[model samples]
Target: MSSTANWSYTAQATIWRCLGRNEDGILTFDRPVVIKCDYGMNARKGSLDIGRECVIKNTIWTEYGKASVGDYLLIGKSSEADPISAGAEEIIHIQRFADTFERNADDYALFTGGD
Candidate 1:
């Protein structure tokens, strides 16, 4: 997935916490994904979470290994996405794009407890 945020300070851009805080799902690809956030020098308000349904379509790469999710992966977004704390009772449901490895249109993941 790709994202952009414009902030003027080096603050907490995104706070990522797992859904179940218990399970780390599957690893499907070979190349690790890259989330390039071209924020301003002092951008203070921008962040994202790796909760679910995160499809990597571009050719970005890294020496680090790739990450993956299991069946029914999901993600949610807003004009604004952020790092937050939540309980496991509610899972994150994310949608997918055509380039995604999955033939379906959605992926979901759940995170519980909090950081």
Candidate 2:
């Protein structure tokens, strides 16, 4: 596998760690953290799911750390300035370097999810 530092990141996004739901049944999140990543969208033309007539899949790659499944990812916006205005997508999957490999600064994480 190629090192993460070798890849060029063209976009930025903010990640909010999910702190789980509250007693009232509302989800709460921690402070947002900005990360540099390479983002792309794939158009699924012939999806079998009728509920999703048109599906667009979003994928992102960034340095491995501070993110996991169920976290909130806000694209094209920073939560520091206006956290309430932007809508966040929940992270469904995370692909990271295997533990079999040696630890290095160049390791990366791949995140897949979004409407």
> Which of the numbered candidates is closest to the native, going by highest TM-score?
2
- Alpha carbon lDDT at 10, candidate 1: 20
| Model 1 lDDT at residue 64 | 14
Candidate 1: what lDDT? 0.23
Per-residue lDDT tens digits for candidate 2, residues 77-112, read 575633344576666566675433435544355444
Predictions in order: lDDT: 0.23, 0.62
Model 1, range 41-98, lDDT digits (tens) per residue?
2212222365433323212121111122221111222122222221111112222224
Count backbone clashes in candidate 1: 24
Runs of candidate 1 exceeding 4 Å displacement: 1-34, 37-82, 85-91, 100-115
Q: Using Cα atoms with residue i matched to residue i, what is each candidate's TM-score against the true structure? A: 0.18, 0.67
For model 2, where is the 10-residue window of minimal lDDT?
Answer: 46-55
